[model samples]
Target: MSHPDPWRTATLGNGYAASVCVTPDGDTVLWLLAHGGCIEVDDDYGCCCTDCAPHEQLNRPIPHTMRSALDRPIQPRCSRPRSDGQPCRTPVARDGLACHWHRTTKETAR
Candidate 1:
């Protein structure tokens, strides 16, 4: 089997790591190190949209040191089954202090 890359590779440690799931509308939910975890922004203006389109965007990725995987809010899209078929809480806290998973973007004016 092949190994999955944990990092999203937006800008090294300063960019969105994962491009979770995109809304039918346009909002992008990217995994960042800052903003605590998840970061919501214009779909056409974030680096976490590599899986989106190869268009020039605005926001990039913040510095890893300045990024945080906490204080964001996230919602669970699906659930998983355990060995006994028990469902466990797969918290995808995007912007809450509880879960440490959020998407981030860098500035384009830079």
Candidate 2:
């Protein structure tokens, strides 16, 4: 028997977002976390990453559209493994939380 894959949560401007694997190896997340999550194959496939694994996990596609300079808390605070068969690297975003393998975005790092 199989178990529900381990999951992780990311805090967004609205609330919490959860991400889980569906295919166990399909290279993308199943979009089980939040309502606005990107599920379309094309929309969810690309990574705004360097060390990100070939597999694409659903990322919070929402961008900070603030008209003024504001701060936001990072998500995940680290990368979690997916149910997908192969391995992947932790995600690193500009303003988001620090994952196991990524660095703070240069803008904020200063």
Candidate 3:
């Protein structure tokens, strides 16, 4: 007999079937069926398992607006100007509104 793949969908003791996989840290994650045939991942968030991995697992559906926000283009240009008096075209910091050089210079000046 051929062994079944652990990631394959299996009967979960109901009409529901889900694919379960173990993460690198050994957390049992289940891709369960939600409403309207949408698949949702169950990372045992409601369970009392103490050894559950700290990494976030998708268990809820994200709104279309929020999902689109992730796909929105990031045009992070530096706020400072160049030596010719034109606006800087360098990319800004991911964590802040300023670019790397401007942020460091401002910090050192304080």
lDDT winner among the candidates?
3
- Model 3 per-residue lDDT tens digits across residues 61-88: 5555667888898876775755687766
Task: Give me the candidate number with maximum TM-score.
Answer: 3
Q: Where in model 3 is the C-alpha error above 4 Å?
A: 1-72, 93-96, 106-110
Stretches off by above 4 angstroms in model 1 are 1-11, 24-34, 44-110
Question: Which consecutive 10 residues in model 2 have the weakest lDDT in total?
Answer: 48-57
The digit string of per-residue lDDT tens for model 1 on 29-99 reads 54333333334444443434333322323566544433444434446522333346554344753322222
What is the C-alpha local distance difference test score of each model? 0.37, 0.37, 0.51
- Would you give me the overall lDDT of model 1? 0.37
TM-score of each: 0.18, 0.19, 0.25
Compute the lDDT of residue 47 as modeled in candidate 1: 36
Question: How many residue pairs clash (N, CA or C atoms closer than 3 angstroms) in each of the candidate models, in the order given?
Answer: 27, 5, 0
User: How well does candidate 2 match the true structure, expressed as C-alpha RMSD?
Assistant: 18.4
Residue 98 deviation, candidate 3, in Å?
Answer: 1.5
Task: Give the backbone clash total of model 1.
Answer: 27
Q: Which residue segments of model 2 deviate by more than 4 Å?
A: 1-6, 16-20, 24-32, 36-110
